[model samples]
Target: MPFMEFVNFYLMPGIVLGSIYALGAVGITLVFGILRFAHLAHGDLATLGAFAALGVVTIFGVSPWVALPVAMVACAFMAIGIDKLFYDYLSERPKIIVVMSSLGIALMLRAVVQVVWGVDTETYTRGIVRPDDYWGIRIRDREIYTIIAMFLIVGVLWAFLQKTKWGKAMRAMSDNPDLALLSGVDNRKITMLTWGIVGVLCAASGFFLGINTELKPLMGWTMLLPMFAAAILGGVGRVEGAVIGGLIVGIAEETSVLFIPGEYKAAMAFAILLLILLVRPTGLLKGKVL
Candidate 1:
């Protein structure tokens, strides 16, 4: 393929993949910064959100856009419930305990999805979607939607953190939980708020991933490595850093095929993770150290 063709095909898709990863990473970062846990179940929650959307779309015969909100709300509630059931009691314990709980949650969630949706691969819509060309470059509608959604979602979140009272409360809690609590920041309320945002982000990520490809029980699980890589790369507590890290990881994964075998493509995130931890443990944006 020609240079621009290569760029158009590889780089553009990378951005879309990055956007999905960023969405999931932002959620991971939020939970980490606020609750101080690794949240291994984050990707599985995304999978639940996607399958929720699929169910809504199938049952109601509604557009995917319409089902987005439904799935987000559903997942948000599920996240809150999960916190109450599992993480709440362990809150006072070592955060590692919660991390192990999250892995269990991940397995439970994947099993739930498999039980409900079956193990078969499913698509949001039938028929092939041809890409639309612009200035000799082609892009799919879903890919465009993914990019736009990521920016809008994360941009509004940043603005919220900068402008809103609850946003400040959340940030204060992240910066210093004991101090924030002493200063009248309601820990319960802030914890719930973080989970809500994380839930919505997971839904968006899973929805986009499903739209871009096909949905299976393990899809979100497969995405966990890159999503965590993005979160770590961007800096654990910095949201914007997640976006940049996600893009870098996404682009690297795509472009690496030029130099390495495609079968090992998923290993790209693993390599990036190790390199960053070895050199700059904080991340590209000087985020919180793990």
Candidate 2:
């Protein structure tokens, strides 16, 4: 294969997929960091956000750009509501039990999605997959936009956590919830805010993933393992770790097709995760421990 052909076929797709995984991983990591639970429902939250965006698009017949924000807002509220109902009650329980509750929540949300949208796959645009070239890249416009969006979002998030008061509070809580509470951090409000940010990120991640491929109820769930792997590889609770881990996982999986079957590509992430754990379980970035 020509060098440029390899770049187009392999490099660009890896970056694009990495961006999506980064977005999804960041959300998972944040929840694990601040909320102190694995939050299996996060995948379904991504699915919920995509469907929410789809609903907005169907109702207003607007561009995805317009529908995305509206959907994120809706999902953010839904996340807060989920916290108020399910998580709040179990806040004092053993962390593993809460994780199990999240799994139950995931199943319920999946059932709800099936009931509302049915098991059929759907998309916002009939001709959404427009092939486009940029510089020398053979990619869809959506792919380019998604990658750029991921960088911008992650940058803004880093700035927020590093420079803002609320961000500091979040970090403090993540570092030590007891200390944070003693220092007057409103744990409940912080929890709500964490879910809101996660909800928005989940929406964006789901939207990009669905647009890049097809939207199915189980799609987010399938991505969950890879997303988790990225989080662990980058270091759980570390935002930058998620981004780096995502890129590495993306590249590793895609490039492995040179030796392994494409069907086994997903397993590469797990392999990487295991190796990373054996070496430095805290993650490459040395993020805070749960």
Worst 10 residues of 2 by lDDT: 127-136
lDDT of 2 by residue, 151-183 (tens): 999999999999998999999998999999999
Among these predictions, the greatest TM-score belongs to 1
* Cα lDDT computed for each candidate against the true fold: 0.93, 0.87
Clashing pairs in 1: 234-241
Q: Against the true structure, whose lDDT is highest?
A: 1
| TM-score of each prediction | 0.99, 0.96
Kindly report the root-mean-square deviation of model 2 from the true structure over all alpha carbons: 1.4
**Which parts of model 2 have CA positions greater than 4 angstroms off?**
128-130
Ten residues in sequence with the least summed lDDT for candidate 1: 1-10
For candidate 1, give the lDDT of residue 1: 72
